[model samples]
Target: MGRIGVVTFPGSLDDRDAARAVRLAGGEPVRLWHGDDDLAGVDAVVLPGGFSYGDYLRAGAISRFAPLMGSVIDGARAGLPVLGICNGFQILCEAHLLAGAMVKNTDLTFLCRDQRLRVENTNTAWTCAFSPGAEITVPLKNQDGQFIADEATLDELEAEGRVVFRYLGNPNGSRHDIAGITNARGNVVGLMPHPEHAVEDGFGPGTDGLGLFTSALSGLLETA
Candidate 1:
């Protein structure tokens, strides 16, 4: 089975959930600490949601400088599959692994709810299990979830088919209703929704988000 690393920072609240999701998808979940520079040779990595460092300096500003993040940035550039959920997405942007910046919600409040999303591009490693244009539901929670970028960047993302997931309801006012996006190589993905929280039925929303993990595992197996 593939081994997926879940990085836990001081204030990470969803690392366990992400690990559980990986296990549910038939992969081994390896716990990694933020202070540790090693990734233990995991095939993939997940930066789960939560208030890292108490959300102290901006949302992801502090955690982006964590010791392990350097390795993550290098690995992601080399095509190691990486998924960033919620605050993880923020860190990815701050780390320059992804484009755009996350700001406060238009409503200026921390929002939490089951969000509807459409799989816009399934070619990414983290979304290949989903079909293009497929609609799914996942739990979303965060204060700084609004995605912002320049017009050219938005146009480029659209033209390049890099917009992996789009919000069906435009909850947090992301540009072009984007909910998730992947790097040009399709190995790194970041999104503001909590797929880890929706991996099991009877707990949160439906199991629609499980495809994120399963798809990554399939990608790993294909290359293996």
Candidate 2:
């Protein structure tokens, strides 16, 4: 089975859920610490959600420079699969692994709800099980959820089909309704939704989020 690494940073709220999701998806779960310098040879890495570092200096700004981020940066640049959820997404952005930035919710309040999302791209390493334009329900909880980029970058992302997910109701005021996106090579993906919370049968929003892990496994197998 593929070994998946889930990083745990100070204040991370979803590391356990992410690991459980990986195990449920048939992957070996490897716990990784933020201060560690290595990835423990995990096949993929997941940056789970929550207010890392207590959201100081912006949601992801501090965690982006965590000790372990160096290895993650190297692995992602070498095309290893990486998925970041919510606060993790912010770290990816802060680390410059992906483009754009996130800000306060348009409503200026913490938003939590069962959100509808359309899978816009399923060819990425983390989303191959979803069909293009497929709709799925997942939980969204965050104080800062808006995704923003300059016009040129936005155009590039749109033109290249890098936008992987779109919100159905524009809940957090993301640009072009984008809820998630993949890097240029599709190996790195970041999203605001809590796929980890939706991975099990009885807990969370239901197993609607299982496809993310399955998709990663499929993509990895295909390339292997």
Candidate 3:
């Protein structure tokens, strides 16, 4: 089984959930610390949700500089598959691993709900198990969940098919209804929804999120 690393930042609340999701998907979950410089030879990595660095100066501004992020950024550049959720999404943007920035909801209030999302791009490593245009419901809870980017960048993303997920109801006032996106190489992805929370049946929204972890495992197997 692939050894997927689930990174835990000081304020991270979903790392264990991510690990459990990986395990459910038949991958070995490896715990990775935010302060560590090594990736522990894991095949893939996950940055789970939470108020990293207490959302201090910015939602993910501080956590971007965490020692582990340096390695994460480097690995992502080299084609490592990385999935960042919620606060993790902010960190990826702050680290420049993915485009766009996450700001407070347009309502300027925290939101917690089961969100409907369209799978726009199934070509990404983390989304391959999903069919294009599939709509999945997952839990989304965050204060800074609004995704914003300049028009040109947004157009570029649309043109390149980098927009991986779109909100069905246009929740959180995210620009273009974007709920998730992938890097140019499609190896790195970031999204506001907590896939980890939706991985198990009888819990969360449903088992819709398990496809993400399974997709990653499939990708790793293909490369192996």
Residue pairs with backbone overlap in model 1: none
- In the range 1-224, model 1's lDDT, one tens digit per residue, is 99999999989999999999999999999999999999999999999999999988798999999999999999999999999999899999999999999999999999999999999989999998998789999999999999999999999999999999999989888899988898899999999999998898899998998999999999999999
Instruction: Report the lDDT tens digits of candidate 2 across residue range 1-224.
Output: 78889999999999999999998898888999999999998889999999999999899999999999999999999999999999999999999999999999998999999999999998899888888889999999999899999999999999999999999999988999999999999999999999888888888778889899988877777777
Report RMSD for candidate 2.
0.9
lDDT values, one for every candidate: 0.94, 0.93, 0.95
The true-versus-predicted C-alpha distance at residue 170 of model 1, in Å, is: 0.8
Q: Residue 18 deviation, candidate 3, in Å? A: 0.5
Please give each candidate's TM-score.
0.99, 0.98, 0.99
Which candidate order results from sorting by TM-score in descending order?
A: 3, 1, 2
lDDT of 3 by residue, 41-155 (tens): 9999999999988999999899999999999999999999999999999999999999989888999988999999999999999999999899999999998899999999999
**RMSD of each predicted structure:** 0.7, 0.9, 0.6
